[model samples]
Target: MSIQKIALVGNPNSGKSSVFNQLTGLNQHVGNYPGVTVDKKTGSFPGKEGGKIKVIDLPGIYSIYPKSEDERVVFEILKDKGHKNYPDLCVVVVDVTNLERNLLLFTQLHDLKIPTILVVNMVDLLEGEGISVDLEKLSELLGGVPVIPMNARKGEGIEALKNAIYDFNQTTWTPFLKQYATHDHGLKHLPSPSEQIEDTDRRFKKITQILKFCVKRAEPSKSRKLISNRIDKVVTHPIWGYAIFLFILLLIFQAIYELASVPMDLIDNVFLLLSQGTRDALPPGVFTDLIAEGIVPGIGGIVIFVPQIVLLFAFIAILEETGYMSRVVFIMDRLMRPFGLNGKSVVPLISGVACAIPAIMATRTIDQWKDRLITIMVTPLTSCSARLPVYTLLIALVVPDKSVWGFMNLQGLVLLGMYLLGFAAAFLAAIIFKLIIRSRQKSFLIMEMPTYKIPRWSNVGITLWEKTKVFVWEAGRVIMAISIILWVLASYGPPNRIEKAVSAIPIPENVADDAKMSYEEQVSSVKLENSWIGLLGKQLEPAIAPLGYDWQVGIALITSFAAREVFVSSMATIYSVGEDFEDEATMLQRMRQEVNPRTGQSVYNLASGLSLMVFYAFAMQCMSTLAIVKRETKSWKWPLLQLVYMTTLAYIGAFITYNLLQ
Candidate 1:
């Protein structure tokens, strides 16, 4: 069967992605566009007579004459004829309730002369507002393009939309191009205009003509204005809004801790069983130990947080769907202005909870270069899910397992404080950056406050599932690979090293069996300081020693750069090698019991625990974030700078904390 490509394009909050998801269902793959951080979501659908259709969801934009980096990406892709993966058909999704504003992009697409099918989404919203669009007249005015009115959320008009796509032909849509040229002469030129006036004028003329002919409203959307005003009163108020936002944030953090515990415990126990079963089934050997202790536990460390990650995404998706996120941006914009950020930066900064890479990528929405750069630089300060395992484990070890104020978990509050510290750091850095780089360009915030809609459970579920799955698969691959490598590194030693040492030491005859032990047994039975890993660990002991880390902690630190969560796995791998511990909790308890050989003091006291948490909180410890920064900035300069600066800060902070506590 032939493969036909369809691209979904729409303004932000126009239900473009919802339409894509409804049509494609579970058949989508998300990855970066060939050379950009802009997400490329492609999916397949069964076409008429068994033909296959490929659909691409382009980033939302206001116009083809782009303003922000993300909007420019949409224009770049649509205009580049030489680009691979060009769309064969363009499905321009417009919210029927806001046709005048939504049709701006549709008219731009028609000017591009792409095979266009107009999808008037949110038709259900029109009738409720006492507004109605004449489909036939609108279709005729749009130059004979197939116009399908769809309620994308309810699956209404989807079959007709699919048929429209299957029957799409460029030849049938030339009149729309002709009409645009005749009515909006600014669009007719030999090549794309160079000056800002010419470009903006052209887009404005084209959109104005489209709205004049095709759109009619019963009355201005009073509800949109009224609800926006009402919500804005409480949410964007200088005093109350900030307080409410903080309370909401705290509630989410507390809930994440409380709700995720049961599922996390179940996952931990399941993995423990798997490891124990592997150990019991296999012969007592190095390979068996690697599988049971290193690989299983290492992978399990990342997998256990899937529940929490999903919950985070779920809350975010619901906020977005309900149009509350826009209010958040509006409320925070005034406050963020002093910090060289706009309201839009709130989305990316909040998204940093999932991962800094995507959050940094999302900064493309910021129009100003200085604002975008500062946002990208400081977004990593927001605590990501990768930090959760480390924070959870350390908090459990230090904070008592009890609640305060009859509602807040003490450990959860500590976790909440860590997140707040990250936010505080981001704000401080942004303020400093703003002061250092002064630009006088006035960028106004023009955001569309969409009508609040009830949260669609299916949509929210799909979003949460997709995000959590990506986190698991991407992070899991790196963790599992690193675990195997670490296992090998810690397993073997120089030849005759153990035997020679044993021979040199005088032993009683009654303990001959202990002396004649096998190589694996001797390696496992020996103290870590006498092993190869221990030697390497000791070599770095001097460097991190002032930061309250022993050689073993230094080893974990070195390995954790692969990912922040790997700290837990590294500790598990190191501790599980010769011990009989069955699970992570037991292993953590054993670590706390460990004493420094020279000082005869506990290894993981309050000082060391605080230092480690501070280090992870500040350090650029994830290779994934670095790789993404390199990809986005297209230079080693930024990521390298990020790594160096963050690592220095982490070192200084850890050093201070350690010394003060000691």
Candidate 2:
């Protein structure tokens, strides 16, 4: 067999991914099927014989008749004999507890004439649930297809599974095409999709016949079902479910604030020391400034937030691994329906709180184009981790670092409020987009609620690791480039003005005797004020000054288009290079004392801090998010709409906040 292919196909919650992981341990590659958001996972391992077995893990689906684009991928490859992905062997994973529903998809693959083996997964739950399946009889009913019962999670029967694959591959079973061609109806492939109904009905009748001959059942206890249902009583209840969900979100945000703060501070201090060391150790030049100010602080900006990203992804992973994310989807479905989104959309929306790129990718699970587009468009409204550093910096500057009512950290509460604000904005904007977009297709929420179990620690760690890599590399490149450009812009100026501006900062007699800012400080200020970025910041100042921001804040606004977190690094670089250093002060400290020339007051007072925070809270600043949106929508229109609506909201919200606070 030359590169024999095995495609893992099963219904949702059938433990197919676990089985794939077991079969191809530590040898997997994840990529997207060209031009689609659906993930394609392929891996290989040595077989019982001297050959290598290539495994393809396709997305979970209920049928080969393709309800979504994701499902269509399954049908396209399986139906085309010459397609590269047409599997030489199909491993159909079946959830032993929910074997009936899983068998439906398996039967579809059988009718489509694909060589297949049935892997009865999660059989460990069978003994506990008082159920048993006869593998021999099941194989006999399906024309003697190989059947292997295994608990994929514990690696039980993995050796048996490998042996079965080796045997099956050696003598691959020819599909039972007569089952479809000889049906009394004499049905063949129909050109229209609706024509599959009669064929599906025939398949169901055959499935019932197979179950009668090959399956045995005992009355199982209702305790497991009751446990889930009872929990749903509060969690899925219309009125209370919303309350519980809000409480859960609050807990997540509170943890982000309480847990991630220490690491963030430590990272900040380390970067400052490194910068100082570079300046002290090396000769002053363009290279030294680039290393000390540009690259170091740029990298520091992203790595500083890793702790928060990990915590966010960890919580989401555990929720998904425990099967609670499905309940979140079910409950939020009702809340989302009026906004013209499916309950399944809750996944993407919630994921957006971590990052919109993956969140938008998560929308692949949404079958309807209209609902998925709406979800993608509004997901960015949910403040992601990129905005966390910006939120933290601004909140610390404006909100006092004290507890409210001796219980809550006032800053943490404000942080939570900002997140909630982001979510609310997303919800409201989704409603507006819903009204504008037109689609004849219906929306649905057909999701499987996998049995709740203790989250597998290995799976959770893997999830955290993968997501962190994406965050670091994807966001890291943009930040590093933007930081370098920003430093150059802030460092140099037109020769005539660069020199004259330094001389024009008239050192008062009081400045030599009793001035608050030294002559050196004034010169540093004028130098920045005349630099390329400063010139641009001044040109844009009239527009942002309405929000009580000066030209310096305006510069941050421009550079942060690459990412929201770049605001932190931009400010760090700008202030570090713009101010004369006595003792190294943190970004917040320097921001606090920096005065406005016109008003002679602190540039970052409560009004401007809140204004800046609100601006970032609603802005569309991530280029990657826009690119993904363009890919998903297959057009620039929706992403453009998102950019316009979100940027408008940011401006309006910031304007109101500044004037109101002032």
Candidate 3:
């Protein structure tokens, strides 16, 4: 059966993505358009009478005339009829509260004449302010195009939308192409007086006329505006805004620590049992050992952190949905300008806390090259989700879980401080880059503040699911592959080194053959320390010893450079390769017990944990991030400089932290 193609387009924050998620459910996945960095999301669902409809969620843009790379993608895909993914029908989502501004794009799409449906989103928001749009009249004004009032976040109007889709007649409007005419046939044709007015003025005039025809609103009372302004006065005040932003961050981390502990402990135990069960049921062999020791532990290290990941992203989504994040952006922009960044840089900088990869891609929307490049260069300094596993593990080892000052969790406070340290480092680095780099272009932050409302839980849930799933799969693949490789390298050594090491251990007097478990553990540990991977770690021991890391940590450092989250997996394999699996202790417990050979002290002390945290906070480790930086900058000079500068900062920071904390 053939599937009909439909495209969804809208200005930013028009609920376009919410609508897409509502229609497609779990069927959609995001990919990039061919030869572009902008996201191209497509999905399909069953339609009326055994038919299927495919939907494309295009990048949000304000107009067909592009101002940024992402906007250019929208123009190319919509205007180029021969483009592979061009839509047969277009659904233009319009934010009804901002009707006049949104209609400008809808009007442009109408001129292009691609069988359009106007999705008047956020209708639920209008009634409270005594504003309304006559849907039938709006449709008539658009040449009888279908108009659907929707609250996509609540699943309202979905059935009507589906019915409209089933009843759609693509042939009703012939595809009009003359408005974008590029040819100059019979070119001498003269000046028509109508063409004298600027195109922008004409679009604005049409939008105002349409508003008179269909829209109705009550002007807000002076008192209401005054109250909002008063609230903004404090919320966006220079000192108060920064204080509120910091307080909110602290509150979020505190809640994550308090609420997520029970579930995280449950997940940790479940994985422990799964690993132990594999050892008990399966016949003892290399494959059994691999499954029980390496793969299970590697995956567990990441899986155990799911609760934290979910809570972190859920809070972020809530802030955005409520329109508070935009206020923070405005506040941050005021603080950022001195460092050569503006409020627009806050979006990517905040997103970097989730993951540096897509956060870097997000910089494409920043119109100024200099500001965009500065954001891209220093973004990795902001701790990401990949760092969460490592931070929580180490924090547990050193920082007590007890309450401090009668209300705060000590560990949570440390977590908040660590995140702030990353931000501080990013700003300082930006300032340094600002002093070094030269630019003559000026950019302004043009942002619209949406009306504040309670967060839609449905939208928050969808965002949490998408982000957590992406984190797991992206980290899982790299971890599993590296875990298997690490097991092989740790288990066997050159030319019977394993056999020679085993045979060389002297038998203890009065030791029964059946009671030789301790002896066997000793032999295994010795064999692993002499294995190929161990030797490599030892080679780097001299450089890292000053920073409180041993050979095993040295190995994890190298492996995790491929991806920061791989540090957990690498440690899982490194520690589990020659250890007992039925002990029921989580990886954190095992790490806490690890001893430093030279001093006979615990390896993960307050000093070493803090040192490691500082190292990751400032380091450039992820290869995928660097490759993306190269692609985005279109130059190796930037990424190479990034690698060098970040590594230097990491080493010095780690050195200072270890010495001071110790």
Candidate 4:
């Protein structure tokens, strides 16, 4: 038998994704939807008859009628039968707890004549809630559609769902719902805004009649829903909520510093050894130099940060899975509104901590144009994971590692403060945009809060794996390419410039071995100063001098425009080129020893290190983010304005920081 396609659709928080995960395990990949930048997730599994079953998990929506980009994508695919992604069958997943609201989209699918299996998820909550559902009766009422009760978190009903898909033809078919059946169900025939409201009322009336006979309920214990409400009372408390969130952030940063140190050290040492080993194993030439000095250390600079990145993602996944993130959004809505945003803007802002690309893409969910545009403009101000490596490196260089306040690591405290600073800057920028931008549409938030439950470890693990993979794979490619290019520019100079600079270094004939090695080092440094990249950095030096940055720092500032995280790799590539790799000193040790020849001061002193950190915190350094902003807004004006304002902010902030500390 040929392979068949099945799509999983549901309202937000309806456990649809859990069902998809249960069915497809690790056989999935994420890509963009056709002709759009929205994510498309597809996976496949073997069926009972040994045929393949492909599954596409569409974006969650409340109705078939389009209101947002996500809904429009879903609507386009489902309404067109000839569309390549049009599924052979559809599985409308629903939360057993919120059946009526979730079924709104299912009825629309039914009326459109798409074969669908209604998967009633989270059925395990039924007994505890003193509710009973008759699966057979519900199926009969729904025109003989297959209704499967599932606990997707525990992998229940997966086999039954697969069985239904395999034998869908054997099931009886019935006429569409009488009211919606009158139309041809084509794109041009879609009901207007007012007509949609009336049709929705009719669908609900019919759904309520079906539920009245098939569902029986009784008053149950106050342990679940009541407990959730009680917890929310404290967690969403205006005063306590912000405090709790800050405490959580402090703990997370401390864990990142404490727990990840061992592995990060191990990775650093391994890569150092790899670079040294490659140099020893290969013949001396440009190829060997590129591998050891350029590619190895560059890739290592990024890979070493993986441990910290994993912990960050793990915490985010746990928060989302335990249903606390929604409450966060709820609590933040009031604070967000005054700044020309609502609760919905909170997701993109918080998600920006992961990456600005998807965070900007997430704005598709916000319906108001002015609000979405403002959200996109400020989202990048949130210090993302890309900034973590830079922050940690600079913090280690300047801040003491000792504990403050009896237990809190000072370094972790500084990291938290940086994140808080980013949040403050974002809010301040939102205020400015609010004043400048005009909009008549009033913004509001209507969201559902899910009952709190222990996070599913399987789901958390999957999220960790996917997020880490993307960070490494996407970042590694850019870092590797830049590393090689930088190595070339740093290793070789224009014509005879490098040779003349090196030959000009003077040495005594009867010098000691130490003095001879010193002469060699001096010659290397002089040659590097005249290299192609060096000349470029020198050209930028005058512009950045007031910010306490040298030509070397200027080089990194330039290369890192490709990506924020590449700053570390760029530094690694710059320092490693035209230098001895056999030394036992680590990268940090090398950086510590660097000094300004003219001033005779440590290059990475407190003033400069802190200044650099502040610069990265506010800079518009990532080209990917700029391109995404242009795509999302469909105009160069917003992104261009964003780049100018942010760059100016970074320069002024760095200058003030450097001058104050000096």
Candidate 1 vs. true structure, TM-score: 0.90
Clashes of 4: 0
- Largest TM-score belongs to which candidate? 4
- Give the candidates in order of TM-score, highest first: 4, 3, 2, 1
Local accuracy of candidate 4 as per-residue lDDT tens digits, 382-404: 99999999998888888888989
Instruction: Go through the candidates in order and give the clash count of each.
Output: 0, 0, 0, 0
Query: For candidate 1, which ten residues in a row score worst on lDDT?
Result: 182-191
Error at 157, model 1, angstroms? 2.4
Cα lDDT tens digits, model 3, 1-662, are: 12388899999989898899899987777878776667778888797877778999998888767768887788777776677777877889999888888887887677665667889999887766568788999787667888999998888988888778778864444212334354332122322445524555677887788789788888755665687788788888999888988999989999988898999899888888988899899999999999988898889888888899899999999999988898988888888888888568898899999989888989998888889999999999999988888888788889988999999999999999889999999999999998888799888898888767688887788778778888888889999999988888888778877788778888667578655766866786788788898888889999999999889899999999989888888887787887776666678777887899897878999999999999988999999899989989999999999999999999999999999987
Off by over 4 Å in 1: 1-3, 80-82, 169-171, 174-216, 219-228, 435-442, 498-527, 581-585
| Model 2 lDDT per residue over 239-291, tens place | 99889878887777778778998998999888878888888888978898887
lDDT of every model, 2 decimals: 0.78, 0.82, 0.84, 0.88
For candidate 4, which ten residues in a row score worst on lDDT?
170-179
What residue pairs are clashing in model 2? Answer: none
Q: Over all chains combined, what TM-score does candidate 3 have?
A: 0.94
Error of 3 at 90 (Å): 0.5
RMSD of 4: 1.5
RMSD of each: 3.9, 3.5, 3.3, 1.5
TM-score of 2: 0.91
